[model samples]
Target: MSQPPPPPPNQPPTPPQGGFGAPQDPPPQGGFGAPPPPPPGGFGAPTPPPGQPPAYGYPQAPQPPQTPPPGQPEGYGYPQAPQPPQTPPPGQPQGYGFPQAPGQPGPYPGQVPGQQPYGYGYPGAPVQQPAPPQGGGRKLSTQMQIIIAAAVAVVLIIAGGVWFAMGEDGGKGADAKGTTGTTGGGGKGGGGGGGTAADGPGKEKAPANTASKVAFQKPHPKVTYLTNVVGSWVTDKAYVKTGINSIVAYDLDKGTELWTIPLPGQVCAASRHTEGNRTAIAFEPAKATPPKNFQPCSEVGAIDLSTGKLLWSKSVTGGQGGDDKARFNEVTVGAGTVAAGGTDGGAAWDLATGKERWKPQVNAEQCYDMGYGGGAGLVAARKCGPYDQQYVIIQNLDPATGAPLSQFKMPTGVEYASVVSTKPLVVAADVGDSAGDGSGISDFFSIDEKTGKLKAKIAVDADRFAAECDVTEVESCIKVAVGNGRIYLPTEDHEGSGEYGQTNEIVSFELATGKPTSDKSDAGDRYSMFPLRMDGGNILAYKEPPYDKGGQIVSIDGATMKQTVLMENPGVESVRRAESSFSVGHSEMLFSGGRLFISEMMISEPSDSGVDDDQFYMIGYTTN
Candidate 1:
C-alpha cells in the first residue's frame, strides 16, 4: 500500500507545544557575588579619631602599669595589650557592631552560597542577627518566615494555569483526527455513524417536505431504466445505473454528470458492492428472443467506480442447454472477493485484480439463491426434489475458495424463501406449501452458521407475505433485515380497507429467543415502511403513506426503536396502482458515503411515430 503525501511546507506538522496561554519563564537568577569592598573611610578603612578608642570602642590603651593600686586587680592594672572583641562563630552572620571576615558562611540555613544577606549590602540598613543560644538553639527571624511562604504560593499558581489549558484543547484535537465516537470514515453509507458541523447532533432536522427544497436533481438524457446508486468512498460522487447497459457517475454535491460507461449487452439483473475506492458491478446479460422466457448470458462483468472503466469480465457457464437461463441471479462483493450465483452455481473473483479465485459445484437439478455472508463467506439455498417432497439445502461457503464450510437441510417440510441475513444466520422460508406458490405462512429460522444447526423458528402470518405494488407475487413484499441482535420484518397490513391502500408495519423480533420485542411502536402505523439496510446501530427504513404526496426516509434505532426522519421527498408520491412494471415509483434507494440517492423508472410503449419513450431520474441528498 502507498503512503499519503507529506503536508505542505506552510502547514505545521504537529500541534503547538504547551498549549495556549501558558506562563512565561521566571526572571533570570539574581546576582549573588560577594558585596563590593566597603567604601573608603567606612568602618574598616582607617582608625577613627585617636581619642575615639581607635574606632573600636576599646578603652584607651591601658595605662602602662600605673603601679598596682594596692587591691586593684593585679592583671587589670598591668599593661595588657588591647584585646579584640569576641569573634563570632564560623557559619554565623556578624552582628551590627562586629566586623566579619570575607568568604564566611551566612547565618541563615538556606541562604545562597557566598551571597551577602539582603540588609548587609546597603548603608544604614537594619541588620538583625539570630540571637545567641543560652541552653537551647536560636530561632529564625519573623522576616525569614514570610519569605518562604510567598515562594510556595507562586509555584502553585503556575501549575494550575497549565492544567486548564490542556483540557480545553483535548476535545478539538480528537475531532480533527476523525475520532468523533459516532462513525468511522465520517459515517458514509449505511455502514456507521459520523457527521460534519451541519449534519451532527443538535442541528435541526431537514424539513418533512423537501421536494421543492432539493439540493440537486439530474435526469437521464436517454431512455433507460434506473438500477442502482453507489457512492464513492469519499462521499463526493454517486455511481448510478441509468439502465442495465449504461452507468453514469455524477457529482453528488453539484448535480453534474462526471462520467458514463456503457456495458456490452441488455442487462437482466445487477448488484453493486463497494470497498474503499473500488466498486464491483456484477451484472448478468439478457438473452434476446421470446420475451417471456429469456435465457441468461454466458458472462458477468466488473467496473471501476472512480473511472467508470471495465476492469474485467468472466464466464459463468455450468447448467444445461442453450435455453437454460443460467445467468447469475445474485451478485455480492465481500472483503476479498466478488461473487455471482445463479441456477448453474456460484463463482468468486479477487476484488483487486479481477482474477477468478474459485467456483462452487452445484447440482444441476437444484435452484439456488446466493448472497454475501457479511464478508465472512458466501451463503446459498439450494432446492431439490419433486414438488411434494421438496427440500432446501443451505450451505455456507469459504469466501476465498468456493468450498462448503457447513451445510444443513431446512426443517423437512419448508422451502427456502430468502436469505434474510447471514450475520445473525436468519432464513425465511415457506412451510408446507407443496404447490410451489407462496400462499402459506412464512417461517423464520435462526441457525448457528458455524455449525449449520437450527436454533429457533417463528411462524409469521400469511397476510404479511402480500406482494409489493409493482410485483404480482406475494413473496416480493416480505423484506427481512437483521442488525443489533434483532430481526426486522416489514409486512403489509392486510386488515386495512382499500380506502387507505397498502401500509406496512415493521415488527422486530429478538434474535436469541425468537420472540417479539417491545421496541415496535405506533410511529410506523401511519405509513408503509420497507427495510433498506442497517446503518451502524440503526436501521434505515423507506416510508410511503397510502394517499400522501410526499414520502420520508427514516432511521430507526435498532436497540431503542427511536425513529429519526432522515430525508423527505414532497414531489415523489407512491403510485396508487401499478399501471405497468416500468411505471412503478420508488424503484430503489441507497445510502453511501454519507449521501442518499433515490431513483424511479418509467417506460412508455412505442408510439405510432415509431419513437419509443422511457424516462429515469435520480434525486440526491447528503446524509451528513
Candidate 2:
C-alpha cells in the first residue's frame, strides 16, 4: 500500500471546510483572494454596499475584539471564527473529519459539550481575523507581542514541571502505601500509658475508674523460671527467686540482673519489708539434709536490700519441747527488728547488727504467729484451747525489748486465722456460735493498735467469699486491705453462665460502723480482682481468674469507688489451663513504685513427645 504523506510541521492537516472529503470553494472572481479581503471594515472607503450585509460569496466584516475578563491582559482574546455551509459527502459519513465553527456542537458523539470543535486549525489554515491593520493605533509592536507570548509559555512549562516533581517526592520518599514515621515504644515507658512510680505519692492520680477497656504495653525483660519476687517500695530493684534456695537482685529500669545469693538451705519462708532506704529480707532455712521424718527449720537469716550480701544469720533453739517441729511459720522485718514466730514461740533480732534483741518464752498454753504491726511494733496472735473453746489473744510488743505494749483477748468462740494489717488493726478470724459445732463463720475485725480495743467487725459474705486457697497463703486466698478509713475485700460473683466467666469486685466497708460505704451492685467487676495495696488513697488490684485468657491491673479510688484499668495482659492462650488447687501455689503479685510484679507457676500438660512439668514466669508492668 502506498503510504499517506506526513502532516506539515507546526500545524496539523486541515479537514474539509464543511464536511469530510468535501470540495473546496473556488477563489474570488477578482483573483489572488481580492487583496486579503480588506481587514474587517473597508480599506479607507467604508467599503460595502452602504451598510448592506456583505455578499454571501465574500468574507464577513471584522468585529472589534471582545474585552477579556478582569485580570486578563488586552490583546489576548482570539477572534471568533465564522461558520461555513455544511454539505454531506456522497458516500462518506456526515461530519467525519470535518471542522465545526467555534461555539457550535460537533456532529461526532464524543465531542465535549459547549467546547470548541476538534481540529479547528490545520496546516496553512486561514486566520479568523486578519492581522490588525499596521499602524492602525495598535499599542504593542508585533515583534514585542511575540516575545511576551514566548516568555509566558516558558513560565507555564517550568511551573508544571515543578508541580509534578513535588507530587512524587512530598512524602519523604515513603513507599506506595505512604507509610513514613517513627514507631514508638508501647506503654508508660514511652509516655504512652500506665502509672509511673517516680511520680511519687499524690502525683499522677489515676483517671476515673469507669473505663471498660484498656491498652497494655508489650512485655519486656521477660524472665523465666522465677519462683518468687520481692519488690522494694522505694526502689526499682527487686529480688527475684532464681531457684529453690537462691535469690537474685534485678534492675527493673534496665531489665538486667544485678547480683545473686544462695541461701544456706531450702528456703521455707521469706518476707520483704522496707523502712525508708533500709529494706530487710528475712527467710527461714530448712535442714539441708532431708530426713525421713519432720525436721525443724530453726535457722533464719537476713540480706541487704540493694545488694545480695548476707547481713546476718542465726539459730534459735528455744521453743516448746516435743515432737512439734520448730519452724517460723512467718517472718517479718521492720521497725528496727527482724522477727520470726510460730507455734513454739516468737523472737526479734536487731535489724542493723543481727544481734538477738529479745525472745518471748514459749508456753504449752499459747501458740503464736508474729508480724509487723503497722510500723508501731511487732504483733503476736496467740491461740489457746481447742476448737470448742478457742480464743485469740493479740499482743502488741515492743520491737527493741520484746515487752508487751498492749494485750487483748477475743470474745469466746473466736479463733484467729491471719493478721490482715497491723496499722489500723485488721484481723481475719472465724466467729462461732455457742452450739460449738465448729461451724465458725470467717470475718474481719478492726482493732485499736494502741489499746487492743475492738473497733468494728464485718462478716464475710458467704456467697462472695472464695474458699479455694487457705487464708495462711495470702496470695492465693482472698486479699484484704485497710485504707482511707475503709476496708477493701475481693469477692467473686457470677456474671455469665460459664465456669471461667465469674467476675470479681472490691467490696468496700466503712471501718467505723462496718456499714458498706458503696453500693455493691455498682462496684466495678473484673475477671478476678485481688487487692495489691493502698496507693495514694487508691486501691491497686490485680485481675486474673483461673484459666483467664489474659489479665489486667486496675486502680480503684478509695473515696469515689471509681475504677480504671491500668494495664492489660493479652496472655498466651495456648498455655492457658483450667483452675486447679496447685495453679496458684506460692504465687504472689507485688506492687511498688508505680510498678506491678507477678510470678506464677504454670503447668504444661503431658504429651507423648515430652515430659509434664511446671514452668514459672516473672513479668512486670508499669502503673502509669
Candidate 3:
C-alpha cells in the first residue's frame, strides 16, 4: 500500500479535508465576499492564532500602522484617519513601477460592483453574469437554460472512445523524398529543414507504434514538453523534449539529454518550422532591461532544420514594409510556406532564404494598436476600422508568396468568420448591432477561394440565436471552426448593454447551401462549450463549463449535431482569453507523431498588481 503523502510545506499541522490543503470553506461563490470582516483582532489587527508563537512558518505580510479608535491606542480595526488612495501621482507607476493606469476604475465599462477590475488590472475578476432568475423560481432565459441543459446532456454523453488517442498506431505518409512518416517535400513541413537524423527525442524508447498514455508521462512537467528541434547549425544529434531548462534530445528510456542547444533569447516564442523545412525563433536579447522606448529587438533567426545550419537572421525595424513590432503576430506554417505580418502591412518570406515573397499595405495605426491579430500569416483576420468602425476584409494568401490569393470585402461590417485552407474558402458571419431592445440580424457569406467573389450568401436570425447565449462584447462568442461540410460559430445575443445576456450556442450552417444544419434546441443556450475542430464528420466542443471539468474533451457529431464528451481534463482548466483583449498568448495543443498532445498550465493568484507571476507549470498529456 502507498504510504501517506508527506505534508506540503507551510500547510497547517492538521491536514485540511482536501488533499491540496485548500481552505476547508469553498471559494467565495459569487461577487466578492465583504473583505473577511476585518481579522479577529479587529482592523489593523495582528496576524491571528491568539495563543501560538507568531505564525513563524508563513512569511510576515507588511501591515499599516495600528489604528487608534476613539482616543484609544488601538480598538476597532477601522482607521483613525483615512489614508491617501494608493496611486502614483499623475503618470508615475504605483508600487510596481510600470507606466499604466490605476486600479479600481475599470478600463472597460460595466464592471461588477465590489469586484476587482478585469484585464491588465485584476487577473480573475468574477465572470460577468445577468440578474438573478425572475419569478418564484429562477427564470433563466430560454437560452441560458439550454446552455445549462446542453452541459448536462454532455455529461451523460461521456463514454467509450473518450479515451481514444489519434494516430494510436502511428501515421502513414510519404513525402516527395519517398520518406515515410514525413509530411512535405523535404521530409518536413516548412522549407526550414528536417529534424536531426538522430531518432526523434522519444523515437526508440517510446515504443514503435502505440501512443503514450497520459499516465505514462512524468508528473508536474514543464510547458515545452516536445520540441521539433529544427534550425541551422543544429547537429544531427539535436533533439527536443518537454523539459524546461533542457530542450535537447534524450534517450527515450534513460532520459539523458542528447545535446545542449540554446534559444535565440530568454522569454521567446516557441520555435516553429516552415513547410519548406525552414525553422524560425524570435530572440529578444534586450528584454531583460527594456530600453526607454518599447522597441523589440528585431532579430528574427531562421535556420534550415535538415542540415542544422543557420540560413538567415534579420533585424526588422521601422521600414516601409513589414518589421518586427508589426510583423510579430504569428509565423504560420503551411503547405510549402511560412509567413508573418506587420502593422499597416505584412510580408511573406521564401521559406528557403528568408527572402521577401509578398507584402501588402494595411492600416498602420489600427494594425499595431497594442492588440493581437494584427500581424499577417494568421490563418485568418477580421478587419475593423478606426475607432469603433467594424467593417471587415478577409483574405487568403498565395502559399509561395503571402499575396492575397482571394479577398472578401463587406459593404457594412462582419463581426467574425473562419477560413480553411483545405476547403480553400472563407466564411464570415455578420450581424448589424441593434440600436436598442437588445437584438440584431445575421448574414452569412461564402467567398471564392481564388478570387474574393461572393459565391453564396444567406440570411440568419442572429439576434434570435444570440439571445440563446447572453453574449456581450466581441471576444465572447467569436470563435469559428470549419470542417465536416459545415461551419460552427459560437455566438450570444447582442444586447448593447455590457452586463445582462450571456449564453452558449453553436450556430451550424451547411457548407454548400449556407443553411442551418440543426434545429434550434428549445432549451436554454449551451454554456461552457466552444467549437473545436470538425473531425470524422463531427464537430468537437468543450461539453462542460471550463471550471467544473478539467481536461474534458468533447465532440459533436457533425451529421446529427449530437454531443460527446471525449476526455476529462485531469485537474486542468483549458486556457481562456479575457474579453476584448488582443495578445493571443499561447494555448497548449498540437498534433505530433499522429497524436493529439496538450500542455496544461498551472497558474496562481498574482501576488501583487503589475508584477508578472513567475510561477506556472506545463503538464503534458495525450488525448487517450
TM-scores of all predicted structures: 0.55, 0.56, 0.45
How large is the C-alpha RMSD of every model relative to the true structure? 30.9, 31.0, 21.5
lDDT of each: 0.48, 0.48, 0.37
Per-residue lDDT over 1-624 for candidate 2, one digit per residue giving the tens place of the 0 to 100 score: 001112211111354488432466755666321334643643233325666875322334467768667776555465445558776677755455665566344453222343222111112222233244576575765445445545655565566544332322332221221111111111121101123222134322444432222112112123222222322232545535433355555665443667777775544555545554344443435423433323355666666656667777776655553444345655666577778766666667886788998654655665544333424356667666654665677777777887767777877655444556666667665555321222232666777878888788776645454323243422123356667666776654455222213454565565666655321212222244557677766667665533323455556555334455565544443222211111332445665545555543221222344222222244455533
Clashing pairs in 2: 193-624, 194-623, 194-624, 195-623, 195-624, 196-624, 197-593, 209-563, 209-564
Which pairs clash inside model 1? 183-193, 188-594, 189-593
Error of 2 at 282 (Å): 5.4
Ranked candidates, highest TM-score first:
2, 1, 3
Which stretches in model 1 have alpha-carbon errors above 4 Å? Answer: 1-212, 215-235, 242-244, 282-295, 319-326, 360-376, 384-390, 434-441, 464-478, 494-504, 524-526, 546-548, 571-586, 592-595, 600-617, 621-624
Local accuracy of candidate 1 as per-residue lDDT tens digits, 294-401: 445446666677777777877644443233434565566665677766555566788777788765445555544443433434566666765677677777767677
Candidate 2, residue 433: how far the Cα is off, in Å: 9.7
- The alpha-carbon lDDT assigned to residue 500 of candidate 3 equals 25
Model 2 TM-score on a 0 to 1 scale: 0.56
Clashes of each: 3, 9, 58
Candidate 3 vs. true structure, TM-score = 0.45
The TM-score of candidate 1 is 0.55
Residue 71 error, candidate 1, Å? 99
